[model samples]
Target: MSNPAPAEAPTGAGTAPVPHRDTEEPAFPAAADRSQWRYRPRRAFWRSRVVRAVAVVTVLAICALFILGLVREQTGTEGFLVGLGLAVLPVPLLMAAFRWLDRVEPGPWKNLLFAFAWGAFAAALVAILANSFAVRWIATATADPDSADTLGATVIAPVVEESAKAAAILLLFLFRRKHFGGLVDGVVIAGFTATGFAFTENILYLGNAFGEDQEFGSTGLGSVTAATFFVRVVMSPFAHPLFTVLTGIGFGFAALAPRGKRLRRVLLPLAGLLLAMGLHAAWNGSATFGGPLAFYAVYGALMVPAFGLLTWLAVWSRQRELRTISGELPAYAAAGWLSPAEPTALSSMRARQVARAFAARTYGPAAARAVGEYESFATTLAFLRDRARRGTAGPDFPAREQELLHHLWQRREVASPALTYAARATGRVWAPPQYLDYDGYNPYRR
Candidate 1:
């Protein structure tokens, strides 16, 4: 080699291989492109065969209980049918509504289903058993016939019943912190669980209404169902969700808290749970003590404001995420990793949504998915790099992060633009060339 460089091999007829030209890296590496946002779920989650099987059994058991309640009802087929219809009617919309409110990455279907199932099965059974036993025991012990009903109203109903509902949200948090994401997501998950519980519980009451009808005819049942439905579903479908959301908030905090501060994490969640319990108890007390009309006033006066505050907090968190992403991506652009065009496109929520739509139009849903995935990785990398620069991330972290960034960048270029090209070929509108290009030069230039 020292004797004349061993006659250096020729490059493309007197040209050298362009640096960064290996954009399509070996294996569609996860680092080369940061514009894509991957929805790839994390592996080794709590969901497993056992969890699935158990969840299936739990749902079946709930069905069986509902059937038994139906059989005992004097209204027979009509009552059962009505109950079933009512129970299922709001499910899809309710689910969609909650999902819309949730901005953080959604959790697995099974995890959500399980949380709801816990409410329908374990929570329901435990609440009934605990309440009935406690009520009877209170009556016997206190030797006042009114004691059981009094305690049930003042203590047992509020404490045990709400605790049972809160337990569903708690277990979801314990089993799956990554799914918790943040406060908005917490509210959505808890809301669904609460909805499930409310639906099942409604059937019981509806069945009772039907039975009362059997004794008093359709008029009686219709009156009961109408009045109850208007009060429960129409007026305040939010009660259970509001109560359970507190636990969800606690769960969100627990997931977000740093490790090693065990006391702080535990205390925060405890405080949230206490808040949920207090609100739940007060609602139940007001509704029970004041009758339906009084309950209406209390519900409007108190619950509406509380819920409004939660909604505002959710919007605030969303804005914070937008700001965080906006601030972080510019540094990545200055680095060689991202083209100037990309950070602008991704950090703006509107731009991001349009990009996704464009990807989908060009490459179909699959392309859109890849784009989203790449972006998510890019975001994580940006955060990692920032931490490293701040001395928060450890030494050598930047090197490792760069490796990942390279892979994602390559993947983004391939999957992402391929979609754009595909869209053009299919006669779909693609992003304007000027908009897609960067600074009158290709950022991917050598």
Candidate 2:
């Protein structure tokens, strides 16, 4: 240009060429579009094939030991079958309850699988062997087997069983930090672990009850098995989950604690475990205090109130999680990275379901799958941004954010339009005509 003497780049036979002026950058450059970036997945230290294989084998061995121990304790094949059938009745109900609590930010199935397996196998085996040994030793020392049984139930069993179950939660919390984010995560994991423990414990109690009934020539609902079923299965199926949930609350608090609050993080879970042990002791001692009537009294006076309080807290926490998601996502939308209606639509479970349905109806199963994946990634991004704002984000925050953003960008072609239709159908107002005209049609805006 300075050479102006460059003659403005001479024209060809049928073409005209002009001297180049200063080039302005595009508003959305290809380099800035992360969807085009080549993603090199990083290998996690603990996800090595060898480590996973070893973990699988270890869980299997523990499950085998638990099964063998249960058989030995039951003494009859028929009794075991009866216990198995009765004991499984409450599992589905309990699992569904926890799953409902986790609807706001559902954790990975793999994490739940590990929690359940640990509870069913490793925790159960440890509790059984430890409690049996301690009870036998106490009986021999006291020379009073009846008193030993009472002491074992009130003291040794609670300590051993709760500690074993808490171990599983702790392992998952430490290893699966991304999933162990808040109070609901803690509650759900603890619930499943306790459920597994309860399942094994129930089998033992019901089986033994069945054996006693058989020995006494009793049958039908009036039998010892019936009484045990009413007490354990009907009356107090939530007993184990209730106690263990305290420990879970502690872990949940720890998970939300800031990175610098090292002392709080360490103390909270221990406090919870101690509280669980205390509650367990109180419940077990109720029977000794005044027999079954004392059990019923405590159930009404203490346990029921505690359960209601926890249920309310879980529900409240779920609402808070939804609020966080709704509040944080609009910034990205304003920055031209998401559709205007995405934050509101994602905040409502109803809207999400509608979006998925609309996608499936309009664009087939693959599009519906993409919509689901988009919802999950968006939820995760919301949580990550919230953590960053609170100064609790991990070292890899930027990388994780970029990765999630890339995933959302890639799926936006299919998911964004579906979500827009869902929002309109769900009654959210569309963008004004002026705004729409100004923005034009940018399908990849997100």
TM-score of each: 0.74, 0.86
Evaluate residue 333 in candidate 2 and report its C-alpha lDDT on the 0 to 100 scale. Answer: 77
Determine the C-alpha RMSD for candidate 1 after optimal superposition of all C-alphas.
9.6
Best by TM-score: 2
Stretches of candidate 2 above 4 Å error? 1-50, 428-446
Q: 301-333, model 1: which lDDT tens digit per residue?
A: 889998888778767766655555556666555
TM-score (C-alpha) between model 2 and the true structure: 0.86
Candidate 2 lDDT at 133 equals 94
How many angstroms is residue 275 displaced in model 1 relative to the true structure, after the best TM-score fit? 1.5
Q: Given candidate 2, what's the lDDT at residue 131?
A: 86
Model 1 stretches astray by more than 4 angstroms: 1-78, 218-222, 375-407, 414-446
